[model samples]
Target: MTEAAFSIADIPIYGRILLAPMDGISDAPFRCITRRLGSAYTVSEFINTHDFSKLRHYQIARLAFQETERPFGFQLLDNDAGRMAEVGARLYELFKPDFFDINMGCCAPRVTSRGAGACMMRNLDLIRDSFRRLGQAVPVPLTGKMRLGWDETDLNYRAVAEAVVAEGARLVALHGRTNKMKYGGKARWEPIRELKQALPVPVIGNGDVNNLADARRLFEETGCDGIMIGRAAMANPWIFAGLDRDEVPIAEVFALARYQVRAMHAFYPGEKGLVAFRKFIKAYLAPCGLPYEKIVQLMKVTELEGLLEMLADIEAELGGQGQSRFGWEGLANPFEKEQKA
Candidate 1:
C-alpha cells in the first residue's frame, strides 16, 4: 500500500483515530472515557451555534477537556456566516481548541431543509463566504466538515474542497454521501480521493468508519489525511483502538452499557438522566443476542439500579461474556503505551 498523504491531521493529531461529534450521545463523560480508551482527538458533539449561544445556562460540559486529550475541537453548524464567525471568535478565545470546525455536512432534515449542512453546499457562493468569514473571525485554524453535495447528479466535492481552500480554510473533512443519502448507501470514497487530489489543504474522510480496518482503508483508499468516526463510537468506542475480533471480548458491551447509565445520571441528574440513559443502552446490548422476552424486560428498565440488576442477572445467564484473557497496553502499563493497535 502507498503511504498516507497526510499521516497526522491539523497541527499534529498526537494519535491516529478521532471521535466524531454525536449530539446527545457524545457527552463529556462519554468523550472522556472514550478518549481514555483510545483516540487522537475528540470533537465536541455538534450543536447549532445559535442554539448554544442562546442557552441560558450553556455549560457545554463536554467542551471541558483535560490536558490529556490534546488537540480538542468543537464542531458547530449554522447557515449564517456572520453568526458562525461571531461564535467562532468567542470559542476560539474561551476554549482555544486546536481548531474550530463549521459543520456543513449534517444530514438531518431540519438542519438541511433550512439550508444548512449538505443543503448549504447547493449555494457555492454562500459556502465560500462561510469559510472566508470564519477564517477571518476565528484565531485558530479554520476548518469545515461537508458532504459530497446535494446528490449524485450534483457531486461537487472537488469544487467545494477547492473553494474552502480558496476561502482560507486550512482543512476540510468530507462525508462521502449527499444529504439526500443520509447514512444509507455506501460512502463514496472517490469523492474523498478526488478532494484530496483537488485541494492543497488536508482532506479528512468520514462516514461508515466503524472499525480500524475501515479507517486504515479510508486513508489508503482515499488518500485522506485523517478519519472521523461518529456512529461507530456509539456502538463500540474501542474501534479507534482495535478491531472487535482483535481486541478483548465484545462482552465489554455490557460493562459499557452500565457505565453509560451511571455517566448519564452524573451528567444529567434527576429522573431525566435515567430516561435518556435508557435510549443509549439499546446499542450496547445489541450484541448480547438477547431474546425478545429478555429484551423487553431490559428495555422496560427505567432506573439505574433496575437496569444493572437485569444486566448483571443476564450476564450470569449469558455465560459472562465480558470475561476475557485479552490485555490493553494502556490498561497494563498506563504510561508508556500510546493509543493505537
Candidate 2:
C-alpha cells in the first residue's frame, strides 16, 4: 500500500498523528498539553462503560477536556453490549464527545478479567454485538482500538475489523501485536497494511513509533490513514510537534514539566493532584537523563512546593555540565510495568 492508498472517512480527524488513550497517563492535564503541543487527536483514557453511568468524580476528571482538544474520542471498554449501549446514550447526553471508541486492545489483567479490552477479540459474537449496540445507542461516529487477536493461533484482526465495520464502525486502529505480545517484541506492520487493504474504513496503525522517522515509516510502509503513539509520547510530549530532544533546552524541559504539574494541581487540587502528577516526573525529564537516585529523590518530593524546590536543586547540581548524564535506557516504564511483565 502506498501513501496515496490511505484515505480518511468523513469524521473530523484533524491530523494523522494521534495520542493513544492510556490508563493512568492520558489525564486531562496531559491531553491538553499534547493537544497544544501538536497532537492532531487525543483520546480520553479508556473509561469503563459501567463507570460512565455514575459519572464519578475521577471519571468526570477523565472526561473533562479543554476546548483546544477538538476532534477527539472518549474510549469505552465493556463486555456487556446492553450495558454499553445504555451508558453510550447517557454519555452522549452528558459529554457529547466527537466520537466514541470501543476499546478492544487493552491487555491489562483487571480489564481482561472482566472479559473486556483485548479479550473482546477472542469473541467474534461480542465484537459484532458491541458495534451494533453502540451504533444503535449513540448517533456519533463509532470507532475501535484492537490488537491483532488474543494470541498467535487466533489472529483475528481481519475478522474483528470486518465485523465492526459491517456493524457500523467509522474507523479502526490496529495495534500490530496480539494480546500475548503485550508490550514485548517488535510490532509487525504487514498485518496493518493488509487490514488497510481489507477494510473500507480508515485504519490507524499503532505500536513502537518512537520518533519522527518511525511515524513516517509507519505511514510509508503500511499506508495507514494515521498513526497513534503511546509510550513514546510520555517520554517526549512534543513528539507530535516534530520537536526532537536535541532541540529542547534544559530550561524548556523544566518549564514544560512545571506546566504539567500546574495543570494537574489546577484540575485535581490538594494532595490527590500532587500525587497523581508524580507519575509524569520521569517522562518529562527523560531527555535530561536524570540519575536513578535523583529521580527517586524527585519522585519522593510529593508536595508541589517541595517538588519545585527539588527541581531547582537538581538544575543547580547539573549547572556546569556540558551534557546530561545518561541512564534513561535502563529506566523501567512505570506505566507499562504490569502489561510488559
Candidate 3:
C-alpha cells in the first residue's frame, strides 16, 4: 500500500489531493470519479442539519456513497450545537462515515444569513460548544473547514481554531480568505502557515490552488498536511491525478466525460440525470475550442442519447479516437504508480 500522507483520526488518507465538498458539483458520481482518479478521500456536499433532521430526501441522497469511497465524510452546516450533534449521531447510525466535518467556511448568503457557515467564526464560544457536543455525540473524530474569519476587521481564526481543537476537532481545513472576501481576491497563505504552526493536528490548506505546481507551492509555503481542490476540480478532475487540463490527451478527456455522464445518469433518476449533467458538459468542453453555436447546441440537448450523439460527433471532430498520435492507451491509476514508487 502507498504510505498515507495523513490521517483523519485513525482512518488513513493515502493522497494529499482531496476533492472539496462542493454543493451540486461534488455529487456521488463526481466524487467517485475523482476518487478513482486519485483524490485522497471524499466529502459529501453540505448537509444542512435542519433539512437532514427533518428526513428530507435531497439531503438524505447527498449522504449516499459507494463502499469504495471509504474514508468519506459528511459535512454538516448549522448554527445549533444540539441539532448538529443529534443529526451527527443519526447519520453515523445510518451511513457510518469515516468522520464528520463541520462546515464553518461557506460564505453563501443563504448559509451565512442563518448565522451558520463563516458566521460561526464570529463566536468562539459557539465553536467550542459545537465541537464539545459533536465529540460527545459521535464515536468518530470530528473535523472543521473554515475561512480566516467573518471579515478583515475580525480575523479571529486563531481563537476559533484553538477553541475547536480544545473541544475535540482532530483536523482543520483552512480556506485562506475572510468570509467577506467571498472569493473576491487572492487567498492569503500567511494565515495557513500560522495555523500549521499553531495547530497540533493536521492542517489542510485550501483556496487559489489551481494546478499541481500551485499545489506544490501551497505545501512549500504552508507546510500543510493536505491540499483541497474546489472550483479547479470542476474543470480538471485530472488535477487529483497530478495532470493538468492541457496535459490530458483528447481521447482520455472524452472517455472521462462520457464516463461521468453515464455515472450521473445511473445515480440520478430519469431526465433529472441529464438535466443535472448539463452543468458539467460546458466544463468538459471548454478546452475543445468548439464554436459558440455548436457549444449551445450541445448544451441544449436534453435526451441522454441525443447528448451522447452530440458528444460523439464532437469527439470525432476533435480527433479523440486517434489516440495513437498522443501515444495514450487509457487512464492509468496514478495511485498505483505512487504505490510502486
Candidate 4:
C-alpha cells in the first residue's frame, strides 16, 4: 500500500494510532482528552446493536462527540445477521462514523454466553452472514475486531478472520487473546502476524501496547498497519503529546486532575461526577510514586476544592523531600547571580 493511502477498511485513518473502544473508560470526555493527547484516531465504547436499535439514551450519549473528535465512530456488537445489517445501515445514516466496526472480540461473560461478542467466532456461518449483511447494509466500510478464539480449547481466529473478509470486510484487527484468556495471559503478537500474512487487508494490532516502546515493538514485530491503545491513555493523557515520556511536571498533573473534575461535572453533574472521576486518579500520580491506595482515597473525595488542596499539600510534601522523592536536585538559587544583572 502507498504511504499516502492511509485509510483502514475505508476509514480515513491517517495516523495509524487508534484508540481502542474500552467499556466505561472510552467515553466522549475521556476520548476528548486522549484525542488531544496522542492517538490519531479514536472510537466510542462498544455499544450493543440491540441497544442501538432500541435508541438507549445513555448509549446515544456515548456517541455524542464534538467535531474535533472526527474520524471517530461507535463500535457495535451483535450476532443476528438480519438485525445487524438493519442496525448497521441505520447507524450509517444516523450517526455517520468514519466506518462501522463490529465487535466480535469482547468476551464479557454476559456478552459471550448469549452467542454474541467472542462467541461469534465459534459459529462460522453466523460470522460470515453477519459480515455479508453488514457490508451490504452500511454504505460505510466494514471492519471487525476479534480475539484469537472463544478460549484456549477453541483457537479459531484464522478461520474467523478469513470468513469476515470474504463476507466483505476490508480490514481486520486482532486482539491476540482467546475469549477465555480475558485479560489473563500475555496477548500473543505472533497470531496477529499470522493474520496479517493471511489477509489482504491491513491488520491493526491491539493489546499490551502500554507505552511508546511497546507501540514501537508491536509495529516492529507484527508488521501490522497500526497500534491501538487503551489503559495507557487512561493513565496518562499527555502520553501522546510526547511531554510526560520526556519529563513530567507537577503542574501538568494538578491541571489534568482539575480539568477532569470540571469535565466530569459538565457531563455527569453532582455526586455521580465526583464518584466517577475517582477511577482515573492513581494513573495521574504514577510518576509521583505515591501509594495507589492513598491516591485512590484522595480521588474518592467529592469536594473539588478539597482535591486541589490535597494536590497542593502533596506538592509541598514533595518539596519537603528535598529531591529525595523525585531524584531531581532542586534549583538551589532561583535566578542566582545570572538574573541579578
Best by lDDT: 3
Candidate 1: residue 68 Cα off by (Å): 4.0
**Per-residue lDDT of 212 in model 3:** 88
Cα misplacement distance, residue 168 of candidate 1 (Å): 2.5
lDDT, candidate 3, at 322:
48
Q: What is the per-residue lDDT of model 1 for residues 271-306, given as tens digits with 9 covering 90 to 100?
A: 655677666666666766788788778777767798
Q: What is the lDDT of residue 62 in candidate 4?
A: 62
Q: Ten residues in a row with the worst lDDT in model 4?
A: 332-341
Off by over 4 Å in 1: 1-10, 59-67, 245-247, 321-341
Report backbone clashes per prediction: 0, 0, 0, 1
Residue 249 CA error for candidate 4 (Å)?
A: 2.6
Alpha-carbon RMSD, each predicted model: 5.6, 7.2, 5.3, 8.9
lDDT of 1 at 307: 77
In candidate 2 the C-alpha lDDT for residue 137 amounts to: 90
The sequence of per-residue lDDT tens digits that candidate 4 reaches over residues 110-207 is 88888899999989998988888888887777788999998888999899989988887877889988888898789999988998888989888988
**TM-scores for all candidates?**
0.84, 0.87, 0.93, 0.85
- What local lDDT does model 3 show for residue 145? 96
Q: Is candidate 1 or candidate 4 better by lDDT?
A: 4
The residue ranges of model 2 lying beyond 4 angstroms of the native Cα positions read 1-9, 54-58, 316-341
The candidates, ranked best first by TM-score, are 3, 2, 4, 1
